[model samples]
Target chain A: MLELQGIAVSPGVAIGKVLILDREGYRITRSQIDSADRHNELDRLRTAIAEASKRLEQHRRDSTEKIGVDIGAIFSAHQQLLLDTTLHREWERLISDSCYSAEFAVSTVLSRYAHAFRNMGSDVMAERAGDIRDVERTLLEALGGAPLQVSGGLGQSILLSHDLTPAETAGLDRSKIIGFCTEAGGPGGHTAIVARGMELPAVVGLGSFLHRIARETTVILDGFSGRVVLQPDEAALKDYRQRMEVRAGRVKQLTEIRDLPAVTQDGTRVTLLANIEFPGEIAASLQRGAEGIGLYRTEFLYLGADTEPSEEEQTTAYREVLSQVDGLSVIMRTLDLGADKVGKFTLLEPESNPSLGLRSIRLSLRQPRMLRTQLRAMVRAACGGKLKIMFPMISTLHELRTARMLLRQVIDELAEEGHQPPQKIQVGMMVEVPAAVLMLERFVREVDFISIGTNDLIQYTMAADRSNEYVADLYAGHDPAVLRLLQTSVDVAQAAGVEISVCGEMSSNPITSLLLVGLGVRILSASPASLPQMKQALRQVRLEDCTQIAKRVFDFDTAREVDAYLKTRFAELLPEMALGV
Target chain B: MGIHMRPADLLSRTAGRFECQVLIENNGQSIDCKSIMSILTLGARQGTQLNLRVTGPDAQQALDALCELFEQGFDESDSEVATEQTS
Candidate 1:
């Protein structure tokens, strides 16, 4: 049995076969086939090649009809390349002689051809490598390999990979993927946030373990202990199974307190809400006793689809979530694309530094029609109800004002079209950029509410990318500057009488949730899975003690010092909560 | 800037018309002209010299058509002016 230890980013225990993924998140199955199956594998290769050729033929015709001969000819070339006689012979040779699996042989042959083309000392030849990859992916799909997206057709397995981008993590099929064990990612990475949001067991930063395990190897991932045991002995399996049951019992205990009020011991009530991606998750959020949906990230509607969702589709989805909440306010944040989530939806040129480039509000402002369609949907979905709209990654007041103006124009246009406009809808902006916080008073006056998205705020403030492990230590939520900014945002919002909340990953942590509560943040929005624990933590503490804890952390010089102080105080004040945390 | 011809298109349009075995030898590599992929791998840029070898019943006809096509630069228009912009 092989044992590896890494940082545990999510809680729970899972034992299942692992699906190995390459850096690009494509499933890599390279096991050797039995010698007897060589003929069948060869037949499989032939069948797949035929299937891919047919698909390319269809694409060629479609493109020729829709686009022109130039585009259609590209697909025709792909088809010819797929049917390349020499390539077919090479694949058959690999399968029959080397007894390699059809999948392995196909990837090997295509990769070899692509490599050869890349080194041919001509720019045009190197460009043909991309065509080879397209053919390779097409052939693989025809061979019944998992689709390129990693979100579909993936059976039950623990996903092991080098790392997962935020977009890939967000698109993970929770029903099929049991957990995540990445070779390189920090606890504060966006993958951790998504894993925690989905309540999947994950352990990251297991450096160089992808080379040790084969695909579909039964492994035990103990998220609580941050250990992954490969091919575990029966005793280890039994122990892990028992631990899983115990963790489940603990979750059951937490769920028992779900219906209870999220009120501090001193009679201070805080609104606890859920951050959800899909409208379907609203029921689960409500089951976990979320008072409302604090953050409804609308990017999922655009991410997995070929085209941007129509305004009517967005309206229907938004209306579904709002209707399910039953009068509770649903704060739907506009498309937060780019910066690890850009896909086919945005038409902006690829920037050198995407996080600082045209993303979120910047992209929305540049493409007003994109923003208008989304705003029009939100306006239509409002239907004079408690639907609050918020813009994400608002770095400047001008962007916010422009977005608000576009929203107003959308509302007026809808009204002119004889659509009844909503009576009232609260418009807000996320305080993610440091510039926004520096001008917090100016912002609060122009909006009805503001939520602190600490993920981006901490990333932007420290100049440390949350998704980058090398800078993970620098992306500290406990940094004096970050804490000060949080306090300032809260103070500004409170003085201006604008409803303030924190819907970042930091708020999902038990101690951080208390700190935000102590810093005068009355509403905390986290993943639905974390609501019960946050509720339990809030219920045990008095508002007076929380404020004291929040105040003392500000005096620390470094994040380590602040973290140590918070840990010691949390343990001393709430011993039971410390264990679960 | 030099003359440009879409090698894949050049091969796709003519390679299959002959029953002869067609080969284009460039830079000490002999590539099958019938395979668009092989023809592309030649990386035959502008001002590059290539040797054509054909052997079959229609070898002479194949050789004549191919040589004429190469001379005409596959009938490509304004290729030198187009100058395949390299990034």
Candidate 2:
């Protein structure tokens, strides 16, 4: 029996025969072409090139029809690479002049270009090496070489790969793919994001040991714990089977309440919303019964771009998202760039401590043009559907007022330009910093709503970076100090008659959601996948019970004590909930 | 075909076309136009003149299309919004 530990990107337990997708770095043998067969060898090269081009064009069309035009452009580039006269001539020359075989010639020429791309000294350029390699493999397959494609059939085994690109992940056959593990990729990567959206169990960053695991090996993947056990003993297999059954039961229970309202037994209706970064996620969120989009992270538009997106570009994107969401309100967070999430377009000096450095609202305030451009697009997109603009990392009232002022200015400017201003839109602030929580009373009166960004709030309150494993233990939302702040903000917002939502990781946790509801937080925003589970857990507990639980939780001194108390309490109250939490 | 452009900008506009190799040589730097990474390494900017060389079955057609693209200044009409969602 062998075990591998990795970062769990998605939650679930999957057991299947391993199907290793060893596509990268496939070996190609070099050989001399016989003089008698040189003409046939050249013909083989031409046929291979044409076949690869046809396949790429078909993939491009399929991608356009299934996903969108932008992704189809990737395959279009591949097609262009196939038709590149320079590359074609290089291969032809190797066959005619160097007397190299077609497959060897193609491999050698493509790898030379791939190496050139990799040695470009730019990260963006280096990434294109993967694309070159992808095209090379496709050409090799067309040349009667060993097939590099992953076969998809019903009930196929789990996929293990070095890494999966966005295109590869998108093309995944949902019916065949049981789950996937990769040696590289983070939780925020496109592969993990798609896995979460598809509700597929995935574990990434497993390191190189994963590559050594043979095909068809029986393995148990615990995505929740980010562990994969290979060739387990009978006792271990039995235990895993029981755990899987329990999880399946829990999932079945959650699915039963998928369409049900997130209300307690006492009829307190708490709104459950989804936090989405891309417009493609709206379908999944709505399918999972999200009331509305609570947080539409807009920073993604600016990140990974060579230049700043024009106002029209931004408007087109926002409008597409708004139009798709129907009439559901979308709280669009304006350009939350800085600290750990800096974009290429926005230039900021390197900081020793970026978490506390100039970022978010501060960065926006410093570069008002960037904020104005986004605000203009947002205001324009408001015509498509219900829109709510939010400013992130508001540490002080001054920053909030300044952001509000800039928003109003953009509205007025648009009006002057003969554009009709949005009739109704709510402006809000994210209560992420400690100062914002302390000044909750003042903040509640200023904005239409308040979103408690528990991720950053807990990190800042505990003086710990959540991403750093060394400080991860210190960064707990259930800590008395953090909980008190959350409670105070909820209390203040309730009193002020302003809508407040907990749009953070904590809102997804059953125990924390119970505590949030007990503390009078009426709205919770989390990933769409967690919505059903959150609703299921929320429906079982009465508001009175939650209130008592919260009261007892508050009495605890340390986060550990509070966590233990809640676990025991929930175990007694709801046994199924205790198992998952 | 005198306008200078970055590799990504050029690729975005023309990479969807037929599979034909294009080579651009300028100031002693020779690079593959089909490969965005190779083009980017050259870092050609405004006013940098490049000699185009095309070779393949569709070399003439590829050359004409590329020359026309360069002549038109790679100005993709704003009417068609290519929405590539980043996440």
Each model's chain A TM-score: 0.84, 0.71
* Worst lDDT 10-window in candidate 1 chain A: A22-31
Of the true contacts between chains A and B, what fraction does model 1 have? 0.31
Q: Score each candidate by Cα lDDT.
A: 0.82, 0.77
lDDT, candidate 2, A496-518, per-residue tens: 99999999878877888888888
Candidate 1 C-alpha lDDT tens digits along A80-135: 78887778888888778877677767776777778887776567667777888888
lDDT of each residue in B7-47, candidate 1, tens digit only: 46566457668887877777678888787767766556555
Local error of candidate 2 at B19, Å?
46
Q: Candidate 2: list runs displaced more than 4 Å.
A: A5-9, A15-198, A204-219, A231-253, A303-307, A340-351, B1-87
Q: What is the C-alpha RMSD of each candidate to the true structure, in Å?
A: 6.1, 13.3
Clashing pairs in 2: A83-B19, A83-B20, A84-B20, A84-B21, A85-B20, A85-B21, A86-B21
Window of ten residues with lowest summed lDDT in model 2 chain A: A22-31
